[model samples]
Structure formats: C-alpha cells, structure tokens
Target: MAGRTLIFTGPPGSGKGTQAAHMRDRLGFVPLSSGDTLRAEIKAGSDIGKQAAQYVQAGTLVPDDIITGVMLAAVSRQPTSAGVILDGFPRTVGQAEALDDGLAAAGRKVDAVIDFRIDDGLIVERIVNRRICKNCGATYNIRFCPPKVANVCDRCGGELMQRVDDREDVIRTRLATYREQTTPLIEFYDRRGLLRSVDASREAPAVESDVVALIEALG
Candidate 1:
C-alpha cells in the first residue's frame, strides 16, 4: 500500500482498466494508461503525437520507441507521494526494458506486475457485447453490466455504442497480437518475482478483490 509502481497487463476485454481504476482509488495512486496518454498527446498535436497520429489513423500500432518515450515522460512527471498504476503500456519486451531503465533513472523500480488470465472465448463474447460511452469513455458490458437504459450511459447520459475494433475479427486479431507480443513481457516480470496472475473470468468485484489481496500479500 505504500508508494510503489505497478504495471497491469491483459488481453483486450479482460477488465484491466476496471481493475486499474479500483487500484488507483484504493491505493491513491495515479493510473497511467498509455492509450489515454497517447490520445491526449495526439489531441494536443505534440511532436510525438503527430507521429503517433499517423499510425493511429492507419490502424497500425505505434512503434515501441515512441510509446516508451511517451510513457517515460509521463512517469517522470508523476508526484512522488502517489506513485503510479500502469496499464496498457510496455506491450513488448523492448518497451518493458525501457520502462525499467526509466524507473531506475528515477530511483525506483516496478513493484509488481499483475496479469489477468481469461479465456479467449470469453474475451470475444465480452468485446462483442461491450458498450462504451463516447463522452467519458466509460465501458459497460451489455450482457453483464448494461446501462440504466439501453444504449445509454448511466453516469453521463451519453449515447453508448460499440467500438469498431470491438467487432469479432478485430477482437481476434488483437488477442492474437497480445499473446504474441505480451507473452514475453509476462515472462520477464515473472522471472523477476513481480508477476501476479489473477483469474479474470469471474465477476469484476471478485477479480478486484483477488488483486487487492495479492498486493497485500506482497506487502
């Protein structure tokens, strides 16, 4: 529970973001999501953002170096007291090494890496049924966590719609790529004794409880 950096990884639709939100609140740490940071930079038209915008527009993944630089910059700016909860960053082994180096330079290192293990069939179903609020980016699973009204966001009253990438084929490709690229990162953390595996097939509250327990056990 003390200030420490934590990285979370999982395939798309695995509820990593939901758990990250819980950890951020419970631990009082900044949740640093690489996707959110990159989007913000791209919106601001920063130098790196311009480069990232091209890949994003073309539906290509941003290069590892660009993502590493952006993430390191974000980590450097985090307040010392709160530390950080990293999500959707270090997708590759190279980026993981770069992140470690960045943290070393900052006089810190990764405290833990939590990987959410879930079945691909479940992921496909979850993505297909998922609805997101365009205004606040809040996600709800139609089958599991439907909004107050159909196609409506409970928090903001925003119109909810399925994301294009959440389609069947796209979800398959994303899960495949995640397995291909992120498996090594998982091993990398595991070797360092910082990896914690959680069953993501259960309910969100159960998964969050497991993660909290794991962190407490580590302490």
Candidate 2:
C-alpha cells in the first residue's frame, strides 16, 4: 500500500518534533527531520553537508535549494510503504513548491500539514527552559522534564547544555521569522484543503491524542 506523508509545521519549541518521534514509535512511520538529516550529513562529512556547513559556520541559514535537495533525497531513500513524517522542512513557498514537484514525480504528495498552534510568548518560555545532552542529543526542559541531576543528562550521564538559539532574544527572532515565512506556506496548504491544527498550548500528550484522532479520521 502507498504510504502517507505529513508535514509538521510550527514555531520552534512547539514540541512537533517530539510528536513526530512519538508517531514514528507508535505507528511505524519514518521521521525525517531536516535539521537532524542535515546534522547527520554534516557528521558524515558528505558533500551536501560540506556545502551546508559553510552557511552554518557563518551563522546564516542554509539556502533553500540545498535544503530542498537534501530533503527530497531523504524522501526518496525511504520505501514507499513507510509513511514519512516530515519535520522542520519546506520553510518557504519555493521549497514547498519544489517538494510538491519532487513528490509528484514519485506519485506521492503531502497528505497533511499539521500546524502546532501555540503562542509566541509560550514558545519563548518553552525554549528558554530547553536543554540537550552534549553527547547523546537527548532533549529536556527544566520546567517540565528536567533530569534527575541538574545540568546532567539522565539517559547518557552526559552534561546538558542550552543551545545558543534557545536564548530569549534569538528565540523571539526565530518566532518572528517563523510567523512571517510560515504564513504563506500555511495558506498554501489551507487552499489545498490539507491543513490541520492541534493546540500545542496543551500538554504534549493531549496534542498527540488530537493528532492520533486526526490520523485515524484521515484513514
């Protein structure tokens, strides 16, 4: 059977990435996070990653074409049977169009776009509390899921550090950029009747339940 493809979009710290992981664990879908994929490529030292690294090192965003190429390649690698949960991709209308073209060529398309709706102030707070394992990359929020020991990762016994982007000023800028860029993309999906939303202001489990119900309804 053909697999469904979903695009999860929202401001940073909305927990959409965590929900993507949850869906992958519970339903066997493959999660393709653009950030994770890029990081992996950079870690692997691939040519694409090399290109991406230049911009990353410069503290600028990776160009859309390069990101689109990596994301399309990522999509093509998975079997048509494993549903794809796309996280942190198609950040622009041009990239979204490219994704549409690429998927159309493969007889597939984005089945839905889940907008994780939350307030910007809440997102800033959430991100400010976020920390990640320096070794294993596990994420935690001090306000919610802090480790057993302060500044230590419970899973890997590694030190936990706050990412630079998790700062309040940077997060506010990112939220502003997200709102500006995602407005058109959200409208693009809405016009296609594939846009759905979950209240991310709620706890993660509650948001996930709504997503699961939406998925079942889609079936």
- How much lDDT does each candidate structure score? 0.87, 0.89
Clash pairs for candidate 2: none
In model 1, where is the ten-residue run with the lowest total lDDT?
Answer: 74-83
TM-score of each: 0.82, 0.84
Candidate 1 Cα misplacement greater than 4 A, ranges? 44-60, 131-142, 145-162
Candidate 1 has what TM-score? 0.82
TM-score, cand. 2? 0.84
- In terms of TM-score, which candidate is strongest? 2
The alpha-carbon lDDT assigned to residue 138 of candidate 2 equals: 99
Off by over 4 Å in 2: 43-54, 57-60, 130-163
Q: Write one digit per residue (lDDT tens) for candidate 1, span 96-160.
A: 99888988887678999989999999999978998899899999988988998999899999999
> Over the stretch 1-219, how does candidate 2's per-residue lDDT look in tens digits?
679999999888899999999999888888899989988777777777788888899999799988987777778778888799889888889999999999987778999999999999998888899999999999999998889999999998999999998899998998898899999999999999999999999988999999888877889
